[model samples]
Target: MEPSNDIKGLIRQSPPVDVSKPYDASTLKGKTIVITGGANGLGSFMVREWASHGANIIVGDVDDTAGEQLVASLTAQYPDSAFAFQHCDVTDWDSQVSLFEMAVNVSPHGGIDIVVPNAGIILPDASIQFEEPVLKNGRLPKPNTKQFDVNITGATYTTHLALYWLPQSGSSPRDRCLLLVGSLASLCPFPTQTMYTMSKHAILGLFRTLRSTAFRNGVRVNMITPYYVSKSNMLKLPVEAAFLSGTAGGATIEDVIDAATRLIADEDIAGRALCIGPKLKSAGVHGVEDEDDLMAVQERENNGQGRAVWECYAGDYDNVDAFVKRYILLLNAAERVKGWFGIVTDIWSMLRRK
Candidate 1:
């Protein structure tokens, strides 16, 4: 007889996160975390919050002044924990590899437990556009790769390093995670920044791809998609503010941080993503009021109460075709066999060490 929840096993994914539930923050204690773009903006905020909870944090950024100063303050505030800074220009391969090496050397456990690819660049660029072709000397201008290079290429480099280091580093399920930070542009289009929007959308693709097989390496892959959010003071920049003005509610930095906190703290949440945005009230015209109210379209009608985070893209595999279902089932079967093989290998290694 077919099992009641056969598809659940086939998917090989953790259940949807219950945001109302609580998790242990001290789980992060002594866990070494390496983050890119940690010198300023959202990365800096996360570094501060995580450090307070006793996690060892290694920050990598191009801003030498800000990165060094942030590390100095963290060292003072959390003397018992670990904090290190490495000058990493994400666009450069050697710079990032050096950053990873520094993390391993300075980590309290001599390994990285969590890796967050948290660096991104978003500028009002009409270079990859048509309204203004940006002709150079009355000719077509070359399309710059700034947005793709940083947001896409740089992030992929971080992911490559994490895949190499995390499996050897983690001791348990709670100890391994590759947390990706995608932006509001990941879901929808932006006006002037075509490349920025496209790059964030590519993040969604990366998340899906990794989640499918990253678990075989003993690492959990998760992503956070935050809505139009202001970083530090971006009054001088035109992109962030322009988008929020048209949206129903603007996502607060606090909410974005909160969303990421949930994913990082909850070890059981694998292959899941949380979308953070301005909290809008639940609408009144619903049959089942909160069935899938986390989606933005559902919140568009009402304006009373609100929430910061919601589980987004939870239905990707929920509805699939026959070929996909069969393929996933085969993959799950192989994983089961491999799981048993890995258990034997681990037992043998432990006895050998003794």
Candidate 2:
């Protein structure tokens, strides 16, 4: 049974997605996807893959040069699909609003099907600096909060905008998804990086909190927690210096893409998380890994094939006590009634300002 009367999660979760199983890439055809921080690296790679599968892709990023170059490259190769780039600084709310507005304007389907909040950065040992400030002129200067703002605030804005716009999934019906990019730091402690770990934990928290409720908008909310040095060694982040670099058994893009596509194309899935890490030899996959390694915590798929993607926190929000059930029902009711008066007041305020 579902956890509540409505806006509830699944009663059960199937095994980790069988990437070998053929999925209908045809489902992606005619759909439109919006990705933030998509100028390079994982975002750029995903753009190429989705565009090749006949999806309209709108990239939002601060890097105009890389964004335009990516769009140009894809437009040339995939003439059938549409590609557009909008310069977006995710930390700025207005900038992100403009990006989404542009997506709606250019979308062939007149709606967004998928959104990836993929823009993130790592400040080498930033936490230690902030916590233990050095005396400059006998006074500590204001610490930089750029990392927290971009990773947390920007992503929060993206999620809020996604909730507002995605409920109206165009004129005709199609799948709606919010694909969140989290990190291994979300599940395990990063002894060296405190701030980064905190931000990822918040992302994981956001996914957990939204998944059960976001379903009310017919949006499937999913997250991917990838290991450091994942895919082409995460060229964007300085993970190479963070350890766990090449041949250190980080996840391949193939597995990340597979897990992502499965969560997206498979409409039945909602409110789930996937961890992408190294594909280890079955013999060594268990005992060989550190206890804290997220990869070691999972059961391998049948046939003992070396694989990456693993399901995180198998609880699907299905088990609920009566008090919890009633609480959720009340919460839904409150949300249904929320913001209307505030929205009206805001509109009037805007009109008066004009």
> Which of the numbered candidates is closest to the native, going by highest lDDT?
1
- Can you give the TM-score per candidate against the true fold? 0.82, 0.79
Report the C-alpha lDDT of model 2 over 1-354, residue by residue, as the tens digit: 632432242423334454446777768888889999888777777777888788899999988999999999988998888889999999999999999999998888788889888888778567778778898999888877777898899899999999988887586888888999899899998876788888999999999878756776778888888886454535444556446544556677777777777777777677778888886454454455764323442345535656677778555333434435465476664543223234347567999994
lDDT of each: 0.79, 0.76
lDDT tens digits, residue span 290-352, model 1: 576354334433243566677887766554444344654776744433232244476689999
Model 1: weakest 10-residue lDDT segment is 2-11
Regions of model 1 farther than 4 Å from truth: 1-11, 127-131, 170-174, 234-243, 285-304, 322-354
Clashes of each: 0, 0
